[model samples]
Target chain A: MTDTAIEAADLTLAYGRRREPALRGCSFRLATGRVCALVGPNGAGKSTLLALAAGLLRPTSGRLAVLGTTPAAARPRVAYVAQDKPLHPGLSVAETLRLGAELNAGSWDAALAAQVAADGELDPGARVRSLSGGQRTRLALALALGKRAELLLLDEPMADLDPLARNRLMGTLMAEAAEHGTTVVMSSHIIGELADACDHLLLVSGGRVRLGGGIDDLVHAHALVTGTGRVADLARHTVVESRATGRGLTALIRTDGPVDPAWDVEEPSLEELLLAHLRAPDAPALITPGTTPTRAVAA
Target chain B: MVEYRIDRRSGVATYLQIVQQTRQALRLGLLEPGDKLPTAREVVEATAVNPNTVLKAYRELEREGLVEARRGLGTFVRRSLGGAPADTPLHGELLEWATRARAAGLDREDTAALFAAVLEEKFPQPHAAPEQAVPQPQPPPERTLPQPQSVPHGTTTEGDPA
Candidate 1:
């Protein structure tokens, strides 16, 4: 088994006692050296989990570890780029890299930082305040890349980038991660380009992990079943989302047992699966690998 | 270097698609031994996929003895597939049979069923699963399961008062 880069067991974090915990009983192990995509709708505890993993926030109760140690211990080796891609407005492009090098101490790679500057087409002398939003994001990423951290936590790194810039940045980050064997955990919209870049998936909803595992294993286990009439036999499978398809009903379901022969079962597209989970916030979870995936009645 | 393209939404997995594309290239004479596969960066630039994904595909190919990853250099094709081209003698023979099947007024699905039955009869493997041995490449246009004989049971169950 691969070592977990991050682990949370019975973890709960709440900003205020009266407010719903941003995260509740959140538990999942992200394997080392894999690019993982964290997906959920707004206010679904995604950002809270990332913040917790970054040591920026402390849990109210329960345990969380990054790289087999507490997040505080892992902080120096972990690089987190926030959703806003924050940067010092007065610093020039060159100065930002220099600041990054200083902050990261001995781990900084000045050459990689220079190459990113060139690729982003930012003049070393250009001030951050003068750069466009996309340019600032590129510079923010350049600093993150220069750190050469063991774990890179990115929050929607491509949100502001154009398609071409997004592709180039993803390519650079992926190649760099591969060359360095760094683990990357990035959060993105439920439907984002380059999701295929992530090999593992962690879906959080309703303040808990709805499902988490290798992308292939999850996709292969679930199916899109379509059939006429309510499939009473399928009442036992963990139905995620279902709707009337004019004449028949189409439903996405997670199952280890046999499906009723009445339905035409096909593998679900990645988008279909994600939308299913997002559409049904209370969709029964398949969190722990060995637990029987909870079944739901036709809805 | 060979370019890798993948469908992010298709039933096929991206890495599996990469593996299949590499194998297809080998069979098509497009990729040969000693040719370097696209670097992880090249693949990411073209496909915008996870770099680890490309590396995983390469590792799979290596495990299958099709390619080898050299440290600090790049992954290389280990050997030629040395198999027949995509269009084998069997393909030409199938085309000839298709013409006869059409003249005989067999519908698309009827032709497939006939072919499946013949294949099952002539080349049945002792240990293969029923579906694999029959090799139905397409999902049946109509529902293939819930055999007609079993329909009455479901109908009766529906008729039962809950």
Candidate 2:
């Protein structure tokens, strides 16, 4: 098994000569056999990152590796599930799986493919256009899994899935990871769901990673403290988010080390932490250079 | 042979409900080592729940070593409560939480109180049965109390209404 499924160093990507870079100086490594969630707001270059990782688009600068080999060289071992469902409307579910198997230069076992389809709760005869959004997503995942790729790059795989479907897909993905040691890097907007399913999280904003680490580590590093006393007057060790609250100045603070005894502290949820990033003033300026401030990534 | 009872009315996520049910089944010996589990689709069909709920439960079970997935076969019960030992992910999560609480300067008493509150909120105690198996009537009201007026910050309330 490869030590690292994905590694990028000082990567910069752009669409056109004059177009601003979609991603700038982004660097991170996703270890093999781990589920890593890439989270950011709309147009934060998440799709571009996946494309570069999958070798669909080459980085303008820096380096990238997928499964111990450059993405372009490891095309057979790397599978890219694009943000949009890339299914052919005229093809049936089985046909689509067959196409994936053929493209990957792998054998397509009818019985095994049927079993996977049944497991995914997809009808073999159902046309791509007739399937619901969730079904389409499942079918896409099934196709990817059937290809037996070493590294799976899923772009917004759970965007259209319902809560239950999302859970099931996560289970399937986890099983795949454990059994085959497949490396999965999936992007998602649902921070809480990702927190529960993924072990590692990469928080991206303005085409760069603001934070990347194990989920437990991030939660332990930050806390939400509520108190009756003035938070600003206590000390400068804590980074106070806000001082005004209906219930006596509840503040979400990040402690430099151990929390002080004066304030009551509780661990903030992933959503709260993500919101803090979105609420920051530099969030808009972080993305594009000259354009007007667009939607904040954290919110 | 594991039996699961789901409370659809509860606000908890369905996957969490399934996880609790599976754990209870293992504790009760309803499921044993090497027992074959219903497929995700079958569970969804039988329970009339989403396939994802069953999948999520199975994923948690796999993480806990309570279940294993056989490629091209299906999920099966791996070990019983007394089988080979391994530190499940949930245990790690609990330990992480404890460390965080400790780092936050929370004492044993504070941690216990917080845990008790969480338990009460997540799994409330059942009310005792009445003689008629129905809710008891409330006692008659003794007197009406007026709502207290809001006081300004640092304002003296001694001279106000008693």
Candidate 3:
């Protein structure tokens, strides 16, 4: 089996000529067996990227690979849950699961699907049109998880669920990853919740990958230092964002080596790191060593 | 089996919480030698934490020689931490002292601070240097208290004494 789950080399996509491109020359890689949190602001092309990886949208330029092959070729092995969660309105919840089973006959995991559906207390006989948004999310996730796909591409999967449901479903997702080593890529706006459930992260903004790598590695790559000095004093390191505090200037820097002892340095929390980069999108993007694309793309 | 309670806002790392809870269980006799710790899948299924975090906690336990992982079975407790259980005379004395402290109008935070001060005096941090061991610089009373570890909030009545 291929170790790389998803790899993109300078991938770009646009809806029309008038509007700006949704994804602008994006490139990154995700290793297998990772539960990665794809986080960004609204209109940040998160959905577009997930669609491209799901084989629903073709990139306007550059290469996109899923599961060591073209997205289209890996469709059967990848599960994609759109934000809308389009399901047959007339079909009952049980019928929907049956359909999923038929579509993925050999790989279908009926017990797991049923259990997930049961955990949400979704009535099997209830029609899809009559289900609430959160219930619909539960059913969609049931189908996606039951498909036993090697890679799961989910867009805002927990948006509609209540707190209890979100926690239960997230637990189920983590269990699946533990048991089968599934590579899950889920996009969500809740950074706090994602921080617990994900070991890796992708922070996309302004149609580019601003931060991509293991959450710990990316967080450790930068330091939040507060000291009495001008911004120029940090010339040796790459400063992502800096602001003047009451006592001195506090800046987040991608450390090249040991920081000077005069400065009080501390590791930035995941939230701090992401916020600093998000506030300054022009900051030099950091893709940790293994998360960088394997193939060379022409600049 | 020990169920890990994760406090996302506690500022303590998630894995360390698991490790602390396991150690707590061992000291309380809730987990004994030859007992099986919950599998990583089981822990993640309940806590929703990253599976790797569970594995990392287990590896730390293994490294400390407190637990051992069998190939096909699961992680088993190698030995329980030797400590005075809840029913011990020392525990009773502490509980009585806490009750008296409560009766004496000592609020929970005040009681915790006083207890922590005594603990720090009796058992100084092993890594502290001679100069640093003289006495902590007192800025504010709150800053003098030991930094909270994985203490679950609202459970100060348990006489944990940690």
Leading candidate by DockQ: 3
Model 1 regions more than 4 Å off = A288-299, B7-12, B27-30, B39-42, B59-74, B78-162
Please report how far candidate 1 places residue B108 from its true position, in Å. Answer: 19
Better of 1 and 3 by lDDT: 3
Once superposed on the true structure, which residue ranges of model 2 sit more than 4 Å away at CA?
Answer: A107-112, A119-132, A229-240, A281-299, B1-162
TM-scores of the candidates in the order shown: 0.77, 0.63, 0.89
In DockQ, how does model 3 score against the reference complex?
0.34
| Per-residue alpha-carbon lDDT of candidate 2 for residues A1-299, written as tens digits (9 for 90 to 100) | 45777777777888888988889987666667666778888878889999988889988887877777778888788778999978899999878877877775643334544554686688878899999887888788777777777888999988898877666666667666655666778898777666545656777777887656655455555677766767664465445365567667676655555555555666676678777765662532221121112222111
lDDT of 1 at A166: 85
Give the range where candidate 2 chain A is weakest over 10 consecutive residues by summed lDDT: A290-299
lDDT of 1 by residue, A111-208 (tens): 88788778889989999999998888888888888888888898888889888888788878778766777899888874557467787888888789
The per-model lDDT (C-alpha) reads 0.76, 0.66, 0.88
Which residue pairs in model 2 clash with each other? Answer: A164-B52, A168-B52
Candidate 2, lDDT over the whole model: 0.66
Considering only chain A, what is the TM-score of each predicted structure?
0.92, 0.84, 0.98
